[model samples]
Target: MHPTIAAAEGLVIDWTQMPTYNTIMSVAAGAGLLTVVWLARALQLGKPARLEGYAVAFGVLGTILTLTGAHMTLTWPLAKYFPFDNIIFGEPSLGFGVLLLGSAVLLWRRRELPETEDRARELAAVIAPLNIIIVGLGLALGAIAFAGLIFQLFAAPPEEPISGAFAQWPWVEATFMSGMFGVTGIGAVLFPLALRGYRAGAPRTAWQWIVGICIGLPGLGFFLFGALNFFTHVGLIINTMGS
Candidate 1:
């Protein structure tokens, strides 16, 4: 039996064959593509309404879709391989929920403001102070994730089993994922507004660029990595269908 087919059906005893895993992956990839477009549009300036719309949609609806797709991917694994494990099921679920809630707040705030550069600057004022703390926390989390990954690479025994590796390091994966979201989804997306605020002589302080750079670097890295992954998934899907 193909590993993909077996893993796809592992949770369902009654189903002889299931394409659930592939379907979920496909959905996730679709949502991810939307997110990429949303992010791109949000990054552009000149039109305030379009900018706000893209930001709100990307932060709120886009993240929601991504979370749903992630949950679908997690379902079979949780039900089959790690039924007794709480962290495996809990971390990503809870982390994504937090991300969604944060996005909701951003959406609500953006909706309340009028579509104008002044209005955008005012919103950036509101975000500038909060960004410092959030980006600082994101950086700390990123450092910890890097440390963990280094340890995993250098310290793990040569004889350690390769199978179920992700299941074995649930916290590491969860923490890294959380950091990635914080840096890319929250910090990177919001920092542009901070830059705008600085340009407009708004509430942003001079030193804020340091925070932006810290968060932006990781955000770019995550974006590139995700792009690579997305293309890889696309190639896999194409090959699968061709066969």
Candidate 2:
């Protein structure tokens, strides 16, 4: 056994027995997919009522993800993995959840005003100022995704006991996860264009389609994976961390 893994034997938290990790991932997945759909609707139809519905959805999912992610990030429940899992999963989940929650609040506030009827325009205007920050975050996510890919592929192959049942598939698990991260990174990088197109009232813009696909695919994957983990993670935790 690796010295790290050996040291972590009895100390590692068993995520399978608890719903915390699964719940967080599931909420993140829901929020991600909802954001993509909301953006699509905002870009295409720009319907006020529909957009407001999405805001409510975001508020619910975002609150769940934000609370769970913040707890995981702050408390570091999975202590064996320490900062790696915290950085790769906890921090991003917290950040995106907060973003979603904030957007929901902003949209909800706009809806309360009698004069602010054009939600699409309001959305575009609200996000435009943050384009630079969004782009920077995109770049950072891309960098982290790239580093994760390399680490998964070379530094920590699935054959390592750490992978548990994933080792049975060799590099397949790593590839799928890395691919998800890659597409999500691409979506983030191109999201500014979608915002720009919305601001310009161009519904059929290429950026919308591209970003939608990029974000939607991973959102689905994460949702399904999180659901699956509800059943499979017990074996994984035991196999990798030992009983």
Candidate 3:
């Protein structure tokens, strides 16, 4: 049996915890759903379907706010680097991710770039930053979740394995990894391809592919990862008692 703390007229029990894994999972799931929504619209005959053109403009702005918060978590309390957690810094990458999406939208709307096969190779340069965001986020989230899982397992007595599709451990790597894996990577890859198609004079179908793959996917992924990170970690946070 795990140990419990004593409290006035009550038992202060500490529950097992796992948050990193959960966050990543949310990120991934959100990305997945968005992907599906965009795909369905791509097949339409008219102008490509969109989540909301102007609304998506907030993509860049929202990313900036989010990155700011994430950076704070890493630097101050989270201490995710030297003298603290050694996982990785993903804030910059997410910034780049938004930049990629924003830029692509701008390019598509304006139709400034000339359409040519040769341009495809050159255009890749524009998309490189986006890919970096995807990789950086994926790796960082995965590593952090893994680290959290180890911490949680060691924090308490180990439980025997139970039969089930999923284990109920407070920390699990998949949760966070799922989050990181969401919009950024696959979307990063697909966006450019679709954007490249658009630049190459491809139809709305091509552009929709990019939007579906990128923007649509994030909501679900973030929600899932956020839930995992929040619920699992809350119990382990060492809450203070009011006298």
Which candidate comes out best when scored by lDDT?
A: 2
Question: What lDDT, from 0 to 1, does candidate 2 have?
Answer: 0.62
Summing lDDT over every window of 10 consecutive residues in candidate 3, give the lowest-scoring window: 156-165
**Candidate 2 lDDT, 82-191, residue by residue in tens:** 44665666666777777778778876776653333555666677867766765665676677677666765323223234334455553556677667767777887888
lDDT of 1 by residue, 8-123 (tens): 42322222222223223223323433453333234333334543454554465345534654554455544342232223223333343344356446656566554445544454
Error of 3 at 98 (Å): 4.5
Where does model 1 exceed 4 Å of error?
A: 1-52, 59-62, 65-101, 112-117, 125-140, 153-206, 230-243
Clashing pairs in 1: none
By summed lDDT, the worst window of 10 consecutive residues in model 1 runs over 154-163
Question: How would you order the candidates by TM-score, starting with the best?
Answer: 2, 1, 3
| Residue-level lDDT tens digits of model 3 in 1-243 | 122355675444433221233244344335434543433343232234343442353354345434543554455434321222212324433444455356536445534433323343343455555655555554454454454445442122122112111334444434443344443445544554444433323345645565564556555556554555454444434331223
RMSD of each: 9.0, 4.8, 8.4
Off by over 4 Å in 3: 1-46, 49-57, 60-67, 70-74, 78-129, 145-168, 171-219, 224-241
- When 1 and 2 are scored with TM-score, the better candidate is 2
174 Cα displacement, candidate 1 (Å): 15
